[model samples]
Target: MLAGFAADLVVALHFAFILFVVAGGLLALRWPRLAWVHLPLVAWGAGIELIGWVCPLTPLENVLRRAAGQAGYAGGFIDHYLTPLIYPPGLTREHQLALGLFVTIVNVVIYGMIALRRCRLRQRSRGEVARS
Candidate 1:
């Protein structure tokens, strides 16, 4: 029972960390502080994903599940969970790179828009100061 609970916690954290990486990028649009960590993680994640690499954690999780006598999934979490939602068939190397690119592109657009809006706000503030 204790081991089962521990395994559950590990799985939960694994899933939550995935969310933290993705949603965290979106949240960074509001809080610049996360950039210190999120920026590098985003780049690393995209690169790994684009290269069709498996993270070490996945194997570790599989090993644990096997010890627990559970059926371990073959691919990464994205393959088992996300692929069904996004694609009709299996996720290949191309699919991983595509997902990485999509994430980077979307985050870039979000950051760009946020920066542009901030610049406009600053410009307006300067103009008001000059007028005063």
Candidate 2:
């Protein structure tokens, strides 16, 4: 009941953070302030994989699930779901490093574009203002 609901909410939040990491970059183009939140998520994604650290939310969700008499998950979702395809054989040191680099690169590229776009917009606006 309550425990199940809590677990579900935790899972949803976890998924949402993943979305924020990717989408937040594009969103930052329009609202640069969002970079504050998005950048941290990028770092977190990379750091977690590099350090082989599980997100705190996973344990919280697992505890709720267990309290609800549901099964608990031992590893992070990526390790369980993506590792099969991404890692294939096993999560070797190189594979783990690659995963971290992948996340960091993807995030940087996204945010980099947003920053470029923002700079263009600002410059354009200034040019117009100068003319007026």
Candidate 3:
């Protein structure tokens, strides 16, 4: 029972982490300091897709599920949980590449906006100082 609970907890955390990786830039837009934490997570998330690496959390969840007498799932967390919702069945290498590219492009656009906002703020501050 404890093992099952823990496995479920891991699944929740895994899902939350994926969300942060995909949309955490929005958080950084509000809290710029968060970008320090989010950028690394974004890199890790995209790298996993691009490199075809399994997240360690997947195996941890699987082990916990097995300990709870449940059958473990194959493939990574995204395959087990997200792919069905987002992509069609049978995720391929090309699909993985597209996912990685999607993640990168999303973050790049977000960070670009952040940079533009900062630049505008700096210019506004400079204009104020010049006028003063």
TM-score of each candidate?
0.73, 0.71, 0.87
Candidate 1 wrong stretches, greater than 4 Å: 1-4, 73-89
Q: Which candidate tops lDDT? A: 3
TM-score for predicted model 1 compared with the true structure: 0.73
List the candidate 3 regions with Cα displacement exceeding 4 Å: 72-89
For residues 20-105, what per-residue lDDT tens digits would candidate 2 score against the true structure? Answer: 76467778777888889889888887787789887798788779888988774335564356324422566676776787888788
Scanning candidate 2 in windows of ten residues, the lowest lDDT window is 78-87
Off by over 4 Å in 2: 72-96, 121-132
12-92, model 1: which lDDT tens digit per residue? Answer: 665665565566767877787876788777777777788777766566656666676667434556446743443336778
If both were scored by TM-score, which would come out higher, candidate 2 or candidate 3?
3
lDDT of 3 by residue, 46-121 (tens): 9988999888888888898899888844455643775344435798989888888999999999999999999999
